[model samples]
Target: MSTPTQKHTKSRKNIRRGAIRLKKISLANCPKCKKPVKPHTACAFCGSYKGKVVKKVRVPKSLRKSKKQEKSKK
Candidate 1:
């Protein structure tokens, strides 16, 4: 059993245990899609990371077929 004064002191000590710190999130812009993304992670808009293309992105159907045909001819 602790006295009321001791209980109050313990609670006050616990209150400031984690009050002087913060976490910093790293943010960067994707060069390809020009959207914000976390550092060293693949960009959700263009599916690229660190200036390298990692994933193929989807385009609208109206533009997809014409783009594919042009590429096939090349």
Candidate 2:
């Protein structure tokens, strides 16, 4: 087994860890739904990819709610 000969300084450790930090994911708007979605992936709201419908996404009328309805309820 081998151990580090010297203790790493706080700033040095932090500098090395800076590169391991989380990176913000880049997102693109879905053309059909205008919602933020990961690029090269199907739009979850509209089920479209690259201007083509790849999957059929259906929301039942009862499940679908509008802002007007929510505001009225509130």
Candidate 3:
């Protein structure tokens, strides 16, 4: 096993620890819903990707029936 030869200074240790801190993730807005979403991925709320619907997200059972009825009628 190997170890650092000299004891690290406070600033040097702080600088290294600061660099190891977690970076905040940046999100982009969904075009359809205008909600924040991770880039290059589908929107969780609207289930859209690049202006197209790529996935179908489920709604609560109470809201689901209304949408299903409306869709069946169309």
In candidate 3, how many Å is residue 71 off?
Answer: 11
**Tens digits of per-residue lDDT for model 1, 3-58:** 66544576677788757678888788888878889988899888888889898878
What are the RMSDs of all candidates, in order?
5.9, 6.0, 3.6
Q: Roughly what TM-score does model 2 have, to 2 decimal places?
A: 0.71
lDDT, candidate 2, 1-74, per-residue tens:
99999999999999999999788999999998899999989998989999999999988677677755898899
Q: Each prediction's TM-score against the native?
A: 0.50, 0.71, 0.73
lDDT preference between candidates 1 and 3, better one: 3
lDDT of each: 0.83, 0.90, 0.96
- Candidate 3 at residue 33, lDDT? 99
Candidate rank order under TM-score: 3, 2, 1
Model 1 score (lDDT)? 0.83
Worst lDDT 10-window in candidate 1 = 2-11
**Strongest candidate by lDDT:** 3
Task: Specify the highest-TM-score model's number.
Answer: 3
